[model samples]
Target: MNETMRPVLGVSVAIWRGGRVLLVRRGREPFKDHWSLPGGRVEWGESLQDAVRREAAEETGLSLHTPHLVDTLDMIGAGEPPASHFVIVVFTADATGEPVAGDDAAEIGWFEPEAIAALPTTPDLARIVALSQRS
Candidate 1:
């Protein structure tokens, strides 16, 4: 029997305040060295909401509030090896504590709307942020 491959389903939390968005420098594979939103994979049997909260806490060392589903992205492979196809669900959230990069994040920073254009963000992520700013 041939085994079918499955796309990794993950969630991301886009924490925004005023005109700035929180971004993280990835520490691992799949986009290492690029600026991206903070989040992680959903565990088996875990609710989406719970997964978002858990990933936020684990990666950023902060507690988020009132997250709302914002957008969904289908990421196709762009680079080499183990080429991933991901279905990423994005959530907008509010958090209190200052962000400190942990786990898979190498660094954390907040980017203003204008600065967002200059960041090395993924194409899908750029679209999400654009729509979010308008909404």
Candidate 2:
């Protein structure tokens, strides 16, 4: 089957500190240039937990662990056969190092929840941040 014909498993981490959340500007599409959590599609043979940690490190250069579940989002395009479908798992984790954009991140910034609401972001990104705060 073609890649876009099936749902892709993906992961993201919400790193919150001092009442702010880390966000990355997406370097690629689906929602390019939009501010989003640091994550990407999971690889074969990798566990979800490992995917979370790997994605965080790859995208932000920050090592994190023991992620708490924050939310899961189904990003599906409306089409005859769906342009794309991604079931993304979200987690909350703590970090020790400053984030530097890499992988699919064009840039990085820390934003308070209120500040996040003003930026152009992926759908439900603001809501996701709110959820992370309660996790």
**lDDT tens readout by residue for model 2, 34-119:** 99999999999999889999999999999996899988999987787777889999999998798899998999999988998789
RMSD of every candidate to native, in Å, equals: 2.4, 2.0
Worst 10 residues of 2 by lDDT: 1-10
lDDT tens digits, residues 29-134, model 1? 8888788889888899988899989998888888989788988988878655436778888998888898899999999988876776777776577778766562
Candidate No. with top lDDT = 2
The local lDDT score (0 to 100) that residue 97 gets in candidate 2 is 92
Displacement of residue 123 (Cα, Å) in model 2 is 1.3
- For residue 12, give model 2's deviation from the true position in Å: 0.4
TM-score of each: 0.89, 0.93
Q: Estimate the TM-score for candidate 1.
A: 0.89
Best by TM-score: 2
Q: What is the model-wide C-alpha lDDT for candidate 1?
A: 0.82
Instruction: Candidate 2: count the clashes.
Output: 0
